[model samples]
Target chain A: MSKDAFFALGLLAGLMIAAWGLGRKAFKSKHYDEMQLKIRATGYRIGFFTALALMAVLMLLFELDCLGIVSPAFALLAVLMVSITVFAVYCIRHEAFLSVDGQGKRYIALFALVVLCNGLASALRLIRGEALENGRLTLSFGSPLLMTVAFLVILAALLIKTVKAGKEAAE
Target chain B: MKNLKMKAARAAKDLSQEQLAAMCDVSRQTISAIEKGDYNPSVNLCVAICKALGKTLNDLFWEE
Candidate 1:
């Protein structure tokens, strides 16, 4: 297998292991409380529409021939990441992102790891001059960067919520 | 419209939001939101909270 394929498989395996650690709490509505389920439902709705809007924008950009730098797959992946981030941030703010039995510290640690790993991968690709093809950003650069940004946003949200909850509990 | 009645009832029972939430099998944030009028809980949750606080639906959730 090619290097990229091997790396992708490894990353997929790592993510699967993390998800398994989270178990049924990883987006299973049955693991959430009633209010959390409701909030998650709204978050899903918002994510769906956000994805729809982004796809429309991508389509418009394609029609206008403005999507020259990035490949179609990168563009689609960016949209997906953005929508998922939005949903996650929304649910985090509403105190519904984590399952009822889920620990906030675990998620915070996971997101932090995601941000770090992806950020370092993107940086390494950039340094190796492997992030561009014919002066257009390639998936190697864009994918990891997008994942870093998405997870960074989620980590920030979770941190802020944790701090706020701490203060509230102190009060 | 904060649910002062529920808060008062909880206070009377010497129960904190976290304790009440634990008893109701919900998150403390859920109880806080319900008390702050930020969320109108489902009837089932209302009943659970009422039962946890040792109050009836009318005593805690009924509007004046």
Candidate 2:
């Protein structure tokens, strides 16, 4: 198997494991609402389909010799977008965002931030003509120094927000 | 946290949390959690509980 194929397989396996863990936690939790259960199930389904689609697309691109080693980055971005869309739909359907609880609002905001970051990164890559390599697109940072700084800033913000949200929920 | 307990006000009512859960289309665990004060039901869920118990939200939830 090619390196790209191996990487794709590894990603799929990791996703599957994470989905299983989430499912198990949902099942064990006594306070999970029906809507929450449905959302969790939908997330698992999306993960499965996303993995399948990624592998299929990667294989096709490889066969066509259109796969750039760096091109998988675009596909990864696409998959992340799809996942965020799925989550947003779930939240809307469940009316989770309308609650007075801060936790729900925080979750919605966090997902929105992720979607925005992914969109910005994708646009930047497109403008720079660096989206794909052979046919495989992998994520790339324009400059190592800049990327590190940006990553740290985002990570810190998210962590702080998450901690505050948890405290509010507990109170 | 308050020690919340969903005690049966009267045995003649004979309503189990499981029965209430089924009537409301929620998992039994949700009902259990609510009774134990471990979970807070959403507005829709609170309404469902009131409907199932033939009582108002104030009767079911508020402490006297």
Candidate 3:
């Protein structure tokens, strides 16, 4: 809710919109094949359940007054990011993250860029010791940190899947 | 449960998985999964593969 938080939120939204615009043509459901569509549907189902479970956990923590330093907004945002990351990783591993005609190298480049930018922002916050305020994580630090970690996890999954696919193809 | 018939048909046509997948408008992994019995293709996909390989549905997909 601070000025930094507002700026961070704005940046996050802008980045997401940019990424979505860049990926929409390559990743649209209409561009996916039947198998990819099925796999993605499964991914969505899994992500939905993951979000539900995470929300339940968050509610429980709130009831127990255990969510000490994390703001409700940040906690909710983290849950959303985690759920989206889970869906993306699952789809990527299953070879359904991209359309049949998609240029995966392009998508990988985009993901790498996202990770790099968010990681740098997070590092800046950490170095400046601005990630925390009165021993509590502020939205400014938590948002970028969460984005960096989530995208890093997705990038790792994509890379592993690509390697495995390459090996399989070679065999 | 492996689709040996489909694989044999694909091989008979001298098409690699990637080639066949391209012809069928699916990912190579999808074709690989189908042949390996790791995933089942829908009827439409079966038709597409059959058409691409110049095989009948019975020739490629019908279990003996």
- By summed lDDT, the worst window of 10 consecutive residues in model 2 chain A runs over A93-102
User: Cα deviation of A104 in candidate 1 (Å)?
Assistant: 2.3
> How big an interface RMSD has model 3?
0.9
User: What TM-score against the true fold does each predicted structure earn?
Assistant: 0.88, 0.38, 0.89
Note the clash tally of each candidate: 0, 18, 0
lDDT of 3 at A106: 70
Off by over 4 Å in 2: A1-31, A73-77, A94-104, A108-138, A141-171, B1-52, B55-64
Interface RMSD, all candidates in order, equals: 0.9, 6.0, 0.9
DockQ of the two-chain complex in candidate 3? 0.74
Evaluation by lDDT, superior candidate among 1 and 3: 1
**Rank order (by DockQ, best first):** 1, 3, 2
- Enumerate the candidates' DockQ scores in order: 0.75, 0.18, 0.74
> How close to the true structure is residue A86 of candidate 1, measured as C-alpha lDDT?
93
lDDT of 1 by residue, A1-171 (tens): 545456556667987998888767755644567878889999999999999999999999999999898878779889999999999999998988764224778878888998999999999999999988776787768889999999999999999988887777789
lDDT of 1 by residue, B1-64 (tens): 7999999999999999889988998888888889999889999999998888888999988898
Say which candidate scores most in lDDT.
Answer: 1
What is the RMSD of candidate 3? Answer: 2.5
Instruction: Summarize candidate 2's per-residue lDDT along A1-171 as a digit string, tens digits.
Output: 654456456757877997898778654653546655655577658656866787687778767877445454445555554554454444333332223132455655654565567567656776787654454454453222223333344434444545654674466
Model 1 residue pairs with clashes: none
- Categorize the docking of model 1: medium
Best candidate, DockQ: 1
